[model samples]
Target: MGLGLATGMEFYTFDSVNLVLTDLTGTLGVSADEASWILTVYSCALFLGVPISIWMAGHFGYKRFLLGTVVAFAATSIGCSLAPDLDIMLFWRALQGLAAAGLVMWWRASVYLLMPKPQRSPSLMRISTMLYLSSAAGLLASGYITDHANWRLIFLPNLLYAAGALWLIARHFPNQPKPSAERLVSADWPGIVLLAIALIALQVILNRGEIDDWFGSAHLRILGFVGAGALILFIAWQMSAANRTPLLWLELMRDRNVLSSALLGVLTGMILSGSVFVLPEFLRNVASKTYSATQTGQIMCVYALTAAAIRPLMVGFIARVGQRKAIAFALVMLIMSMLIFNRLLTTGTPGWYFALPLVLYAFCLSPLLPAVGSGTVARIDQNKLLDGVSLYMTFRQFGASLGVALLTILISHRETLHSARLFDHVRHDNDVTRTWLSTVSGTLTTHGGYTPLEAQQASVRMLAEQGAHQAAAYAYADAFAFMAVVGIVALCLLPIVPPTPVQKK
Candidate 1:
């Protein structure tokens, strides 16, 4: 557990570097959409690597695998920090994703192997809490760093964290064989290749959709076919490999509970990540705060206190009220919270209004984190725990990816349409408006120390910026509308939450 907590510190490095992919267009020469490959590529690598990594862990000792992964993960971070170009940086990011694939699979398996059944949940919570805290820290801190200093500094801390994790595992963890108490899975290279192709191609298309203008662009058109073909091939491969070492364990996804859990995980990710993506921009531009200040403000919310304040209460609720009811109640809080936020948003609103909704939202989100995960993965066949955990983790990661892509696409489209509509009837001959803008421009120039033309340009820039934000406000509201729909849909699936857990074998 200490090792888990120690290894989790790398999660903190995000506070330092989280916005690199988002802001890289301004920082690098790539197009806004092209820069997103950095994110999608990593996800693809992780999806491809998970199964293979799990299989290898069985042959090698547990500590040995964890230590190697830590080293590889850290080394890639160093490469990412020093990357001279976008393409190079993306390569390093993908490598990190591949190497960082199964840290948790091994950790969970080891815990169950080493510890008693009754002791497992608490130990798992310790690790989960560490991750939750680290993530909160990373997002807020990384926001401040990106605003004030350099983005590369974010990657530096991960190096240290990985080193510490390596030292801990090397010194304390025992070198033990993979338990044969459960059934052993056979390898399926053909299915693995097909699945990798499907994920990579599909992720590429989704990641590039917004920037490439979706199907309108030639790049997306080609990738769409590539993705479609891969899916077809993967489906065929799975059909034929049902009893063999299939790329996907064909029977696992067929389980009603497992399918619902995966979908629920996806939905959970979609909302959580959309908020993360939109919040910083909203605070910095719409809320009239500096980048660093915007980030600092979020830390004061209930998100920072979730593991400490929320989790214990949730555990109690589940123990007393029951899991399904607790989850349902939490979902209610989430929807109500979002509604509160949507209602309060206007041209100008106070910070307290934001806080009220955020607290409610985080409170609702808290229980689902543990409840959803524990419910989804715990009941699976013990031997296949590695695969089950890997799938769940992949689903969770993919949710964030989907959220970022969808939010970005929607935000850009809405902003453009609204900004265009705002000045549709404007004329250069409107003296009052022109005079006001000219005066505003002149005053800005004199106060800001620019030439007349330069001041006018600056004023124009400001106008465009304001217009963009106005557009974002609308997009954000719509995004929440979509989120509410998602929440409703997920809630409707409440029947998926069984009265008791799946019977563990």
Candidate 2:
């Protein structure tokens, strides 16, 4: 219960800000682009904070660290609510993200440390269900709150969630021996610093790359060089003999099960997060059925609920059929779902056309984390379980960031190409174009009380608008096609994942 509340709260906090961006822009008197930094900074801080949280949990014990982070999360929530300006809000949001990282990491670590082997898979699925529901609820709740009340009120719910988590954890969590001061002093500060530098640069690039025109921007180019250098140096330092206790256990990647699980984490994360980012934008701006924020949130709730409902069944199937076969099936489902999305997401398609693909995608997502997580935990050394989980999670985060960046670039590039091709046929020289424009202009002049010249101009403007929408529709379809390709790649790699151990009958 404690883990569920804490995890849900963290997920909710991460997502709730999505609906409130417009409100913040207006109330805080910041531009839309500037207001986006509120989210970007939080994401960067959250990723950077993950490694730091692992180290802290090791030193301070998970229970104490969890409680401290909960309190910090609550405090930061209050700070965010009361923030007077954009700068203040961004500062508080960054701290909130750091607190959230600790909360998420420690809660999962607690499960791994405390749960019996038989119970871990089900427990993880339940928590994952809560995560999906909470994030979905965040979208709906924030939209409602933004509609009915001040945007600041969105952070208030965290206090209630934090209080419940703190009470439950404090009363029931197992106690652990305190670490000695020597352990703290021997911490890998150099590795920590390098990791921080690398993550910050990488996250900033992921979050801002589309806006900044990616490699074309001199700023991103320098960041790319710096991030790559730091990552390389960090790897070299970790593998060196002088470093007794590394921040991350690089050697753990040698285990085939661990490596495969981590790789699966990357692939699934890309599909899940990338689709979430893309689908809403498509519905709002590209699809024929332009949905309001509330309507889009409702549609997303269906996806989340379907995944939550099917998660346990999928986990049970994985246990019966084994991870390799189960994952192969899921990948096939993913490919089919992506293709379905590509086919259905057209400029004239109705919103209901997405339900089938969403359900299929949900089925594809439901089994992945639990199967991979359980397989990883079953295979890794008990003493190094936390390290294994942290590594897997970090890979997942990186994959999600990469997915969003790549998909964004793909959509933009494809839209430009599609728009160019479409507009090329709209010239006055083309018979089809001339006839269509003349018919529309004639109708406007006859019934709409427009002058001949005005009707012609309006007809051309309408055609341009329609063409733009069609281009966007084509671009989104191409995005899903790209995802289908990714799914195929995942399917091809399934052979690399070792079979789960046979149970004694």
Candidate 3:
């Protein structure tokens, strides 16, 4: 449990600090688009690494693999802190993602392996709570550090957390024998390579598409073709390798409960991770009011606390209502929360305006994950349980990757459209526009200690800035509205998901 908490902290330390991107960009002498690769590469690596790690864990024994990854994560953190260029930082971040790939998987899998069946649910709930709390705390801690210290310093504290995790694992974890040689040699190497190629191409296209002008650029076109082709081939390979050591558990997709859970995991991943990626960026860069990392972290905590507060009720609620209905309730709350977010968006809205919807979102999302996960594998064949868990988690991480890509593209595209529309009315010949400009100039001249020409220039710049800000704010609102619609569509799938008893395990 202690090791799990430390790992969670290590994962989230970059979450909030990434919000203050201007700080990072300025320090690294990179454009904002390039600086974003710091996150993109990590996610890409993580998404591609999960299934590989799962198999590796079985092959090498869980204890050694877990401990080795922890050490790698610690070493990469030091490299990230010391990196002097964008390429170097991205390299280290990708390595960190590979090292951190199966931390959550190991923690969850350990519960089932180490405890009797009756103890697993409560233990999972407790660990889930700790993980969520650590995620929230990470944003807050990063914000505090970014405000008081340099951006490089944000990576420093992970060393301590990593050390603690190492100590716990080394002293307490038990050893297991490695898998047989035949089992190791039968691994699906080609399928793994195809999946990695597909995901890497997709990530690059998503992150670079807008800047490269999407289909207009040959770079994006080739990547799109490669990603599409590789994905199709990967699916074919997985289906053929069912008798071998397949990377994906292709058989599990035939189960209704597992299939539904995987689909919902995609949506949940999109919504939760998308919110984290977009909200802070919007608040700091697009919104009119300036929010420091600390203030943004406080807003995120509302989500974590609200989620934590509702967790104690989840197990009982699912037991009484069934997993399908519980998920239904969660979908409703989640949809309503997104609607509230769309309704409350404004360039200069009060802080509380954002808090209400986030809290509501927390209530629904907190329980939704555990319910879906437990239900997915509850009645599965004992031998296939590991495959089910790995598939469910891999899809969830893939969903997160999609969410970030979608939101990034949507925000950028909408901002351009909104800015163009808003800028159309800013003509000198328009009486209302001229009057506002004159008024602003006069005010600047009188109170800002500026000459007439200087005041006029300042007024023009101010109006342009305001227009850009308002456009960006509208773009964020559009993204939220899209999420609300997605939730509604997900709600429609509820009838297909049969009710499973919560305590069946």
Best prediction by lDDT: 2
RMSD of each: 4.0, 3.0, 2.2
Q: Which stretches of candidate 2 lie over 4 Å from their true place?
A: 18-41, 75-93, 147-152, 179-186, 203-220, 502-505
Residue range 1-505, candidate 3, lDDT tens digits: 6557556655565564555566778889998667777776876787777888877887768888888888887788889888898889889989988877777567776776677777777887787777667767777887888888876777777777777788888888877666554433356788888999899888888888888888899988998999899999988878884447778877799998788888887887787677667677877776677888888878877887777777777877777788888888888888888888888888888776888888878878777887788877777886577778778878887887788778878887998999999889788998988999999999999999999999999999999998888898999999988888778877888876777754554
- For 1-505, candidate 1 gives per-residue lDDT tens digits of 5356444654554333444444555566787556656655665676577666765666565667777788787788889878888889889988887776656445655666666767766766666666767666666666666667776766766766776677777778877766453223345677677777767767767766766778999978887888788778777876673435554554677665567677777877776666644554555555544344334435433454564456555655655665677678777877887777667655466555677767777777767766666666556776666556656666766675677667667766776787677656333577755876798788977787888888888777776666666666776766666666767877898897666542233
Error of 1 at 142 (Å): 3.8
Per-residue lDDT over 1-505 for candidate 2, one digit per residue giving the tens place of the 0 to 100 score: 8878887887777666754665677789997556656765665566667767777876877788888999999899899889999999999988987887787666677788888877777777778888888877887887677677887888888888888989998999889765454423257898988988887888678667777888999999999999999999999998888888777777889998888878887787678666776677787666776676676667766777888788778766887788888888888888998999898888878777788888888888887667776666667887788778877777766666567666766887899899999999889999999999999999999999999999999999999999999998999999999999988888878888888854334
* Model 2 poorest ten-residue lDDT run: 177-186
Candidate with better TM-score, 1 vs 3: 3
What number of backbone clashes does candidate 1 have, counting pairs of residues 3 or more apart or in separate chains?
4
Stretches of model 3 off by over 4 angstroms after superposition? 179-186, 241-243, 502-505
Q: Candidate 1 — worst ten consecutive residues by lDDT sum?
A: 13-22
In terms of TM-score, which candidate is strongest?
A: 3
List the candidates' TM-scores in order. 0.85, 0.90, 0.94
Better of 1 and 2 by lDDT: 2
Model 3 residue 427 CA deviation (Å) reads 2.0
